[model samples]
Target: MKEIKTKIIERIKSHFQDAVERDYDYNRLDFSVKKETIPSILFYLKDEMNFKHLSHITCVDWLEEKEFEVVFILWSYTDRLQVYVRTRIDRDHPVLDNIDMIWRQANTYERELKEMYGINFTGLEAPEEFLLEDWEGPPPMRRDFDTREYAARTYYTRPGREDAQDVRETIIKRTGEELPDFAKKYKR
Candidate 1:
C-alpha cells in the first residue's frame, strides 16, 4: 500500500513538476497543485489512476492571503490511493472549470462550496434556494463570516424573557417559588 502511494505520488509529481507536496497538520498529505492543472489532475485521477470516487471538494477562504484555497480529496475502492489535490485562487473572482465532468459526485460538493465559501463553481447548478435559502449574508464558511454579526442582522429577538433576567427571576415569576442561594446557582 505504501509502495503504491509512493508510485502514485511520483507519477503525479511528474505532471505537476512545480507543485509542492507537504505534510499538512491533520496527518494528511497536502499537494498544492496549480490552479490551471486542477481539472486535468482530477481527470487523471478518475480515469487513468483508478481513483473513481471523489470524496469531497471544498475551499478555504484565506482572507488574509486574498486567496481561496480549493481542496479535492479523491479515493478509490480498488487501489485505495487517497490524495488531496489543492490549489489557490483569487478571492474576488474564484473561477475554475467545474470538475463535474470527471466525477458526478463533484456536482453536489461544488454546489456546497459555492454556497458556503461564495466561490463560484464556474458552470455548475447551484441555486441559492433551500438550505441557505434566505442567506443574503457573507458566505458562512469564509473566514470573514462573523456569526455574531450575522446573528445580529438575521435573527430577531422575541419580546419574551430570554437572558432578559436571570433564571431565578423567571422561576420566581412562573412558579412563585424562592430558590435558595446555593441551590439557585446549581439549578437551571
Candidate 2:
C-alpha cells in the first residue's frame, strides 16, 4: 500500500508537471488540474505515460458553487490502473475546450454533456438535437431543471396499482378476511 502510494505520487509528479492535487478514494486516483493545463496533462498521460484508454468523461453540477466540473477517467491497459482528471468552470456560461485533440473519441462524451448538461464544448461538432429532440427549455441535467415539475407538465406517467380496480377489496370481501386498507378507506 505504501509503495503504491509512493509510486503513484512519484509517477504523477514525474509525468505531469501541472497536477495541482492528488486525491485517492474508491480504489482509484484522482488528479485535479487547471482547465488550461488540460491539453498538456492529457498529452503527457496519453503519449508519455500508458494511460491509453479513456473510460469516460463526466460532469458534476455544483449548483451551490455555481460551477460545473468535468471529469475524465483514464485507464492504463498495461498496468490495469486508472486516474481521473477534474476541472471546474463557471456555470453562467459553462464552456470547455474540447479534449478531442488528445482523445478523438472524447467527442461523443462531450456531445452528450453538451446536450444533457448544457456545458458548451467550444468548437465541437454539436448537432441541433441528440439526447432530447427539440428540448424546449433548460437542460434537464442542470440543478435548476425541476424534474417533478417537468414530469407534471411534459411527462406522461401510466397509472399504476393506485389506479387499479378494487380487486383487493373484492378479494377481501369474498374471503371475509379483515378488510384491506383500500376497502376500509373506500367504506369511509
Model 2 C-alpha lDDT per residue in residues 1-188, reported as the tens digit of each score: 44654676687777667676565564477888778877788887788677899999999999999999999999887666678889988999988887887788898899899888988887888666877887788888998899867986887766773434567655766897787565566762
User: TM-score, each model?
Assistant: 0.75, 0.76
Judged by whole-model lDDT over C-alpha atoms, candidate 2 comes out at: 0.80
Off by over 4 Å in 2: 1-5, 14-18, 23-27, 156-188
On residues 41-150, what C-alpha lDDT tens digit does candidate 1 reach at each position? 77877788888878888787788899999998877778755678889999989888888878787888888887888777777876555358777777788887788668
Instruction: For model 1, give the 10-residue run with minimal summed lDDT.
Output: 22-31
What lDDT does each candidate get?
Answer: 0.77, 0.80
Candidate 1 TM-score, true structure as reference: 0.75
In model 1, residue pairs whose N, Cα or C atoms come closer than 3 Å (at least 3 residues apart or on different chains), thus clashing, are none
